[model samples]
Every structure is written in C-alpha cells, then in structure tokens.
Target: MRRSSDLSPEIAEEAAWWRDAVFYQVYVRSFADSNGDGVGDLEGIRSRLGYLELLGVDALWLTPFYRSPMADHGYDVADPRDVDPLFGDLAAFDRLVADAHEHNIRVTVDLVPNHSSDLHEWFQEALHAGPGSMERARYVFREGRGFDGSQPPNNWTSVFGGPAWTRVPDGQWYLHLFAPEQPDLNWEHPEVRADLEQTLRFWLDRGVDGFRIDVAHGMAKPEGLPDMDIRPQAPGVLSDDVHDPRFDNDGVHEIHRMIRKVLDGYPGTMAVGEIWVKDDERFAAYVRPDELHLGFNFRLVQAGFDADAVRSAIEHSLAAVAPTGTPATWTLSNHDVVRHVTRYGGGAPGEQRARAMTLVELALPGVIYLYNGEELGLPNVELPDWALQDPTWERSGHTERGRDGCRVPIPWEGTSPPFGFSTAVNTWLPQPNEWDHLTAEAQLEDPGSMLSLYREALEHRKSNAGFAGEELEWYGAPAGCFAFRRKGGGLICALNTSGASVPLPPGKVLLSSGPMDGDQLPPDTAVWLV
Candidate 1:
C-alpha cells in the first residue's frame, strides 16, 4: 500500500483508496448460508471475511441485500433503508460491516436508485392516487389511454424485452426501462432526489465505504417521448429504440451532478456507476471527477481474447477519459454477464486460455474487479432446465440459458453437502456435483492452482506503486501479445498472451501467470518485469 506521504504531488491529488483497489463482487444469493436457510445472508458473508482478507482484496461489493420483491434479483428495491429478512436484517448487516473493517477490508453495497419494486408502499400509494396526485408525481406517469389499450406510450423496448411502457388498471401508463415490476423514478422531482440523498446519508452513517450504483444511466429519460423507429432483428424482436437517445438522454448528467453533491458531504465515499454503453466516448463522460468516481468498463468483458480487440479497448478507454478527470475500472465478469471462463474459454483449451486471460485483465491501467469463482478457475456449471430460476431464461424464450448457471453457490469445502454453503432442505440454487474437486479448500492446498496464481498477481500489483496510479503507454507487440509500461518509480510490465515462450524485454521477472521457477516463466504466461 502506498502511504499518503510517499505519494508524489501529482499522484497524491488523485490518490483515493480505490485507485489501486481490487474489488471482489459477491452475489449474495450464492456466497454462503449462515443459518442453513439455503440462501446466503449477511452473516454468511461476515463468516467468510477471513478468506476474503487472505485473498488480499481491498473491498467487498455486495449485491443488493436490501428489502426487495426479487424482481431483477434485488435491483428492484422496495425498501432501501431496511435489510431483507432473508439476508438477516439491519443488525446482521452492521455486524458484516464491522467484521470486514476488522480485517482491513472496505464494504460497498449496491444502490439501485433508478427504480423501486411495484410492491413498495410508495408505488402502491401511487397506484391508488391516480394521476395528478403528489405521490403519483414521484414516478413517470403518462396521462392518456394506451393505443387500443394494448400498446405503450411510445415504441421504446424494455431491456428485458417487449415495450418499455406498462399501463396500470386505473388507465394510466408508466415507463419501465428494464422490467415492468421495476418502475422508473422521476429524477426531476425534488422530493425524490432529496429522499435518495437521505438514503445515501443513512448508509454512509452506517459505515459503508461506498456504493456501486445500478443501471445509473437509465435514471433519466427524454421528455418528448418520441417514437422509436423499429428495426426488428429477430421475428417480433425490435432493436431500434434500444439505442434511442430518449432512453438514455443527456439529462443523466444532471442526475449525476446531484448524486456527486450528496457524495461530497461524506468524504472518502466512492460511487461507481454502471453505465452500459457501446460507445467508449459516451461511457467515459459518466466518470468525470464531478460525476461518478468510476464507470464500469464493459468493454473488457466483451473483448474476449483477441489481442487487437483488447488493445483497442484499453487505448480507447484511456483516450475517452483523458478529457475528464476520472480514472478507469476494468472487469472480466460480473453477476449479470456470462462468466469469463465460459465466455473466453468455450472448448477443450478453455482452462489454459482462461489463465492467460486473467493476466491480461490484471495488467490493465486501472482498478480491476475479480469475480468470486474466477480465482479458482471455475467454469460455468451446466444446470438442468428445471433447475434454472433466472427470469432472463423465461423472458428470452430460453434462447439464452440465463445467469443461473454462473449464480450457483460458491463451493467452500470439498466433499460437503451443498458445498458447505447451506444445510437447509435445499439451496436457492444447487451446487454442482463437481464442486468437490473445485472447492476453494481443495485449490488452496495446491500451489499450482489458479487461486494461488491470483494471490501472487495481486501481491505483485500492490508491491509496484508505479502501476497503481501511473499513466499507461501501450507498446506494439506480436499478434497475441500485449506490452505496456507504467513508466514511473522504475516499473515496466510486459505481458505475453500466447502459450509459447516470447522474447523478454529485460528486467527481473516479478510475477508470472503460470509456474515460475528461479526467474523462468512457463508457456502461455504473463510476467511483470521490474
């Protein structure tokens, strides 16, 4: 860790705790079960703090544990202040925060500000109040009957599928960018913004170090409600309005400015926005210093293993944010997306390829998020058709298997029932039978395991202060290789993405992806030369 006094004047100004932080994202449903209720809870996560500390992550990003109706997982929060009963209430959350701090790990919970569950008391009241009521103004409500009472206000499509607008039985239409159950909030309302600010204060006062804002770009919508041109990709599948300017309008900047103002009152509290945009330039706008502290890099997740693709993404990201004073954050996988192991490694050579891919992500120029099972080199579990619980499966006509496979419980103990996650009658998601061989306990004992490699890579990253906040200069390399220098404090990292010995660029080898023996790197490895 770089001490405050050790930081150079330029780096010191940008030296926030998250600059070099390694964040571990935990999907609460699959992490661990404390009461054996077949579901992971706050206490379950608390129990695993030592293991997380051992892995050397700077912080833990817990997916929604707040009160919800389980629509879109927990993103449709019904009550922001209270913890869900299934996740063990407010007291258990307090304990989890305290325990993590004891282990020198920071805690950041998911904050879904864009919408609220239909079952929420406020939404329920809005439903009864009809249009023109003060409570109804809290959400977006169109004053009119639907087209033939069947179509929505506009032709916009929901992210999950179908129309973005839904009509209440009372003859009013409302907008929902994602799922119908999650009604979008009206950010234009002063009360709504004030209420959200209070919610932030409530958690900050409770000792949360920061938050990972969910679907942040969807907070604002175009006021004109223009019709989106239809371009049906699949039969009955529309892709036109999907990128409609009205959907993710420029008004989001105002919303971000308001959020940053709230964050200003609480120092050292970080907010990372989940901006899902294809254009790097537009995505970088969300990360300006006055806006969000970090904007998620979905490019890395979608890059796969193509050397040229990876290079373009890194270079584009750096250029996109150069005008803004915000730093970049990279991730290979997350709860909503397909697992990196399965996405990048789909065939017989998947394992070796995944090993090389990890090195590529770690050597990037920003904070990196490591998914739970990635360090263990776990592949996506193939769940039976009947076992899948993800709403995406049903929503997408089963075209995609949905995220249930990746969301399965994390195996902690080898040869244990439910993989030691729960002792209840059954877990929400069943653990794979192969978990016996893939458990953390099994891999921790093996030095050649992916888990051990992750430890070494992380330690190497921390030891090199130059790599933390220094600017990256990309160097041209072979077709399957990438080299970058973090040229300060005398540190340079050159990574080889291929499975063969490549010529070294001259410095002592600091870390390697594969086996290391007396300064020699194994094939298909990455080496940090210092």
Candidate 2:
C-alpha cells in the first residue's frame, strides 16, 4: 500500500517486492524513440525515467528488446542473450536497469520460451541439418503425415491463422504455434531447457528484477501432438474455455517448476506467466508455490462494461489464485488486445467507463499492470490496412485486423501524430489527431484530465492507509451499481453504472472518477471513500 519512498527500498530488497508492486508495461517499440528510427528503444525508456518515477510505479514490465528480425515485433527472438541493434546495445540495457533502480523502479523483461524467431541459430540449423539430426531435436520437427510427406503432420491451427505446421524443403514439417517465422521449441529436450536457463542467467546477471514469461501456457505440447477437440476461435483469441491440446498441457507446469528453480537462485526476482488458462483449478496450478509466482487473468480484460460481468471476473480471478496463496494479477488492456477505452464503448462514454474501471482495478488487492498509455486515457488507433505489421494481418489473409490498433506510439509532448514520440517522419504505428489533448504534456497541466486522475488515485493508493488488505467485503447496491470495501483498510470503492446517481456511503471522500451530484455518486462514476 506504500511506494518505495515510503515503504523503504531495503524492505523491498529483502522482501518479495512484487507482492504489492504496481507494474507499468512498457511496450518498448511504441514507447519512445531516441534515434529517430520510428521505433522505440532502450535509451528512450531511460530518458523517460523521470516521468515514470513521477507517476509512482514500482516496476516496468518491458516487452522484448532482444535481437530479432521484427517478424512478430520482437516476440520472435533471434538471440536470447543479445539486444537487437534496432534497440540499443547491451550497454544501453545495462544503463537502463541501473538508472531505473536509481529511480526506485525495478525492471522486468519479457521472455519468450514457447518459441524463437525462425532466424534463431538453433532454428536455422534445424531447418537444414536434416531429419533425425540432433539440431532438429531442439525444436518441434516432425515428418508430414501424407503419403509423400507433403501435407502437415496434424490439423492444429496457428494462433495467427492457417496451419501450425510449416513444411521444410526436405519434406519434414516444423511446428510454430504462432507465425511460421516463429517456431515452437521442444521443451522435452534437455538442450532447450539448458538454453532457457542460459537466457535467464544472462539477463539476471545484467540486474533485471524479473521476467513476464510470454505464452507461459505453452512450451510443453501433448504427446503425439493430438488434434484439438473444439471448434476454432476467432483469430488471436485464446480465452481458455476452448480446450485446445496445443497449450496448457499437464507437462507445461514442469517447465514452470524449472523456471521457478532458476529464479529462486536470484532473490527478490520474480516470474509472472502470460497464462491464457481458463479453467479455475488448471489456472491455479501455474501459480503453485513451486511454480510461477503469478499468472495473468484476462477475464477482466475480456469482460465488457457490464456490472455483472465485471463482478464475476473479479470473483473468479481472486478465487483461482486463493488456493496457491498467490495474489491475482489484474489488467484491463495489453499489447495483445484492443485498448479497453474502445472496448468499453468508445468516444466520451468510453473514456468515462475506462476511468471508472481503472479505479476498480487499482482498488483491488494484489499486483496490477497498466499499459504504457493507459493513464492518459489513450484509445486504440484505427490504422490503415497498409500500416498493419502484426503477423496475423498477413497470416489471416487480412480477414482480421490484428492488435496494431492498441500498439500506437504514445503521445508525449506535442499536438501532432508523432507527438514527440520520434524525430522520424512517422511512428511505427500512427497516432490519431484527436489524441492532441490526451498527450502527456497537455494532461500534466490539467487538473481534471485523465492523467491527473491517475496521478491523484495512485498517490492516494500509496499514502492512504485504507488501501491495505487482501480481499473485499461486497455491499448490496442498486440494480446497475456495485460496492465493495477493502477488509482491514475499511476503504469503500463504489461504482454507479446505473441510470441515476446514488447516495454516498458514510465516509470522508478520498477521490472520484468524475463530478458527483452533490451527495450522490453519478452514473459511470466511481468513488473511493475512507
């Protein structure tokens, strides 16, 4: 409930800093660009340290900056131990970590263990080393099932689109659960396990506080790579209710167990899995004491602005992790999904709903992650078709517009498209002209702006003694409204999604998402009372 300044860095250093840490996910490629390359880099993040420190976040969960060909925007890591030249060199990364710690902000990086870029040395060698070779054993390489081995080995589909199997020139096929350029690894192989261990040590040696494991539900595939029993979902959606044999296999926990053992060697470091698991008990397994420290529960993100849906997501998210004595990791938007503002309704209504949801998310117990531009109330950009670069764009034959909408570069200081994001002619993804008012510079001066609300809310969350406690006590509300109080803290957070304003509970008002009606909490508004 307190920041490093109030809580003491020594205590965070000695204890599990992640327990109550609020992480701001830095989608590095779209955060800022220091070299005018049109793409963000490590140095850009370092330059913004003052801004982040001012914002009062405990840690930065950065997306991959590893050596890559940009096939899947750095998720397709080519060299696990090296920084991509597109970003700065190893020295830049080292400096970012050191400077961040100086700002009392720990840094956590993304680790893609489920797969690697097709250009990775291991995969490149596997492509030409011939079938049955030791090099091929590092990845999932199998013979095609057709008579002449021309067809794919199985009916499994890629998360991006089409067949998951990509045929090699030698009649053998390899598995890539994502794009063809990113091949899945054979987690059963000792070499693959050792290589992941090496990557972990390499980054930890450079002082990274932790990792946000990419596709943590993957890595271990079922034996024989069995065909999934369910129908296909819309492109890029894996809500877990779809029982796909391609992921969440029983074997995956063993990989997490191995990861935990490695991370345990580095005290105060943690691992939170990007787990897309749905079933309660199955999802809980990932966060067992011996496995991952936390797992991302996307229910909140998937839940729309409905009161019932939101409540169910909170209840389920909390219940799932209770068995393991782990806190639920909650988030409203991410690099992979549409920005929540647009999802809530879009336009002024969307902005109001998004702000209300933020109060709900921040008030909840446990660790919460905020996307880079969320504090400013940035909505998704509807990019032109030619501007799309996500693999799913081409893989799905342009049938689905991928996640580029939410990945637009954030507005820092200007009133234009680039918005001080880059000196280049354009950003990697274009920002909307309407975002001029939402720029960090503009909102910084406005006491009523979205950024100010976030700043004030975070300040209260840190300074107010009422933000303490691990669970909430629900209170009955009007048909379209809901209320809850943090158990020990006695802080009441009430939201009114109803048609009319409601009487406020008795307490000193701490903050509200919007203007209240005298003593009443208005529709689409949330209030924190202590």
Candidate 3:
C-alpha cells in the first residue's frame, strides 16, 4: 500500500488525514455571502477560513458548489468543470482552495455522479436526438407500452414521489430515481462511465484532495425493470418501496471498480460515498480498500439515546469495516435531516441530550463530521409552509416536510441583521427567530455554553496523541450510560443519556459536557477521564 507521505510533502500531510480528523460540513447557500447577493459564495468560504481554523476542525466538506440551476440545491449539476456563477466562478473556487490549504485544512467538494440536471448540455443534446441516437444512449430511456398506457414502464418510484419514469414528447420515458429535474445517469453505459471519469480527473488536475459522492448507491439498478407492490398505509410515498429488488443492484461493485481505476492514478486522493443501507454487511461492501475510502454511517444518526442501541450500532459498524481495510465516517446531523439538538430534545431537556450525544460521537473511531451551527447547540427552526422551498416536501405530500428547518442560515453575529450572513435586505432563507440567543458570538462569550464545551473536547482529542490509533474497548456502565475506553490513550469516555446522576469511577476528569467538580456525574452529561 502506498502511503500519503510517499507521494509528496503535501500528499504525506493528507495521508491518514481523516483518522481522528474533525470536518465541518458547509451548506453553500447558507454559509456566507461575499457579493451581498443574498447567497453564500466561494469567496465567502475563503473569508471564513480563519474562523474554521480557530474552531479546531481539520477539514471542510463544502457541499455542491458546481454549476446548477439550484434545483435540489446544487445536486443537479449542469456542468462539472465550472463553479456556479451565483457562487462565484472558477477563479474564486481556486482561491478558496488556496486559502484553505494555507490554513492546513483539506477541502473535499461534493461530487454528484449519480445524475445531472435536466438543463445540462448533455441531457439537452440527448433529448433532442431522441431514442436510438448516440447521445440518447448515455441516459436510460425506454420505449414500451404499459397497462392501458396509464401505468409507468416499471413500478420504481422517484425518491421525491410518484413514478420514477417521466414521459418525453417523443412518447418514451426516461428514468430518474430522484426529482424529475435530476435525471439518473445510465451507469451501465461505457460512455457515461468515461465521462464521469473525466469529471473526476478535472478536479484532481486542479488540486482537489477528494470527493464526497452523493447518492452513490443509487447509481445502479437491476437490468430488468421490476414491479414493486404498493404499500397499504402511504400508498404513493416513494421511500415505501425503497427495499424493492430494483432499488440498488449488486452491479454497484462494477461501478466502484471503475471509480477505483480512475482514482488509482491520483495517489492519496480519497472518496466517500453516502449509502443508506441499514445492514452493516451490505453497507461495508461499498467501502473496501479498492472502493471508497469512507462511507457515511447513517445508523448512528437514526439511533435514539438508548445505551444498548448505540453499543450495538458501534459494534456492528466496527466489525463490518475492520476486515475490509476501510475506515468509516460518522455524522449525527447534516443538511438532509433535522438538527441533532432538535431531534434529541424538543425543549431544554433535549439540549442536555444533544450535549451528551456530541461527546459520544467524538469518541468514536474514524472521521467525525460536525454540521454547521451544531457547536452552538442550535435547534431546528420552524418554517412556515409558504417559506418552504424543498421539492421533496412539495412532492411527498408534506409528510416528511423535507429538510428546510435544518438548512436555515447560520447565525454568526447576535445583533447584525440576517445574523451577519448577508448584507442584502432580503436573504434567501429566513433567519431563525432565536438568532440572537443562538448566534456563535453569544455562545463564544459564555463559558458554560455548548460551543465552549466543543472547543475543549476537540482540543483534548488533538493534544492526546495516544488517542488517534488506539483500539476502542467497551466497558460496563449503568443503564442510560455508555462507557468505553481507549487502551493506548488511557482514556475512558462515559456519556449519561438519562436525567439522573450516575456513579463515576476513579479517575481525573479531563473534560465534561456539564458542571463537574471531582467525581459527581450530572444528569444528561458526559465525562472524559484519564
């Protein structure tokens, strides 16, 4: 195996870069506005590099900034080679990369290889040529009759809602596993694979360190268009049929192999995939050494505060990937889900739960991602129906309400209008009502705040060199309390998930999520001992 240090001084610095590394996920639209255009831009990110560096994170994962029409919030790329004009052009992006490197922070951009926007030049050319045309072959288009011409060619449904197939004016249908505006690429096509490889090469040549592939498992489907039975309760909801045989095919291995071939030429480059599988064995298949370097573990994000449940999730995830030589990436919150603080707590009690959970996540092996504004203990903002812009909510009958609450702009300054994110009179998304209370500026001044706790915890992890490569060992603890030890580091981490005090073992407390004197453990708190 080639080490990162073997390639170059820079590559060496990135090698094993993710081990014990902290990453901050920046949702481009809500980060910061450079041109006062009411939208965040690449230059805004460059301006904030010092802020991120001071926060103690090792890297930044900037969510899709590629050229797009803003459908699905930049996931629908119109061009892979250029940054969206709304977010700044290629020169601005290059400067952002340079600035991030100056801070010793690695940058990973979101790569949407599964699909492209309907407005993409390739998709436009394919539509004009129709079926059987060379350009049309790059996408999945089928011509056939269905039941009474009213039924779709297959029973597959779009992730947003309704049937996945949309009819063209030419009397044929093209498959789109996501929104209609985001068409799924035909990965089986050699031309499609070649084109995607070129896209990867485009960024690598420009000095990108890695990519975070979106909906990577959805890239392939069963060759035969199979029908899935409709469920009784939510008869039309798309995710109800998620487990259908046609959803994620085994042929994804071939796709991974192709991606691996492209990445092999660029040593030290990493790729992380967002796979939604629940089973550990199946999920681990996507993260073999020859495949993706890391895959997001969604089980931890969905698990409640039960100690048994979290213990099982950690054990299963570790066992599944340990043999494959693939590292795991853990995230509790992102732009796609409800904020962790809100999910864990509906009120003040939930805030305590969020702080406890944060400690547990930080102690886990591999890279940990902290969503923007998470350090400030921000809760989900309540957005009115009229203010919602997520397509998933519009198409899914509002059952899920999409992810609008969590995508609200981050509040940096307490007294500034629009929380100092934009100087424009009207920002894109409405600022949360409690911005003054939750702003980073306010939290930074409070010694007992979650933001300060996060800073102390992260600093402890960085200073303890023994914690990086140490093996994790589970220890017995009381109910609602999860305890684990890292043997090499002589460190023990205990998290209290309940609302009552728990007994503490003999050891000096290195850090605590709540008030701690010598040995008493507070309710809904966490303690790290050495």
Which pairs clash (backbone N, Cα, C closer than 3 Å) in model 1? none
Name the regions of candidate 1 deviating beyond 4 angstroms. 1-15, 143-149, 229-243, 465-469, 489-491, 495-501, 515-524
What TM-score would candidate 3 get against the native? 0.94
lDDT of each: 0.77, 0.89, 0.79
lDDT of 1 by residue, 1-530 (tens): 22334446676554388876899999998898999889999999999999998888999999999899897778889999999998999999989998999999999989998899988888899999988899999998885545565666777767666677888887788988768888989888898888888888888889898889988777787767777766543321112223765445788878888788777666667889887776766777788778898887666776767666777787776776777866678887788776777776654356666776777677766678888888877777788898887766676677756677778888888596587788775788777676687788988878878788788777767776646554776667765777777756445555555666557666877666666545444455566766
lDDT of candidate 2 over 139-243, digit per residue (tens): 999998878888788898888888999988888999999999999999999999999999998898788989999999988888898877657574435555427
The 10-residue segment with the lowest total lDDT in model 3:
233-242
Instruction: State residue 418's C-alpha deviation in candidate 2, in Å.
Output: 1.4
Superposition error at 260 for model 1 (Å): 1.3
Question: Which digits, one per residue and each the tens of the lDDT, describe model 3 over residues 338-449?
Answer: 8878887657877887887788778777788889888888788888888788888877788657777888887888575588888886778788656787787888878888
Using lDDT as the yardstick, the better of models 1 and 2 is 2
Q: Against the hidden true structure, what lDDT does model 1 obtain?
A: 0.77
Q: How do the predictions measure up, each by TM-score?
A: 0.91, 0.97, 0.94
The ten-residue window of minimal lDDT in model 2 covers: 1-10
Q: Who is ahead in TM-score, 1 or 2?
A: 2
For candidate 2, what is the TM-score?
0.97
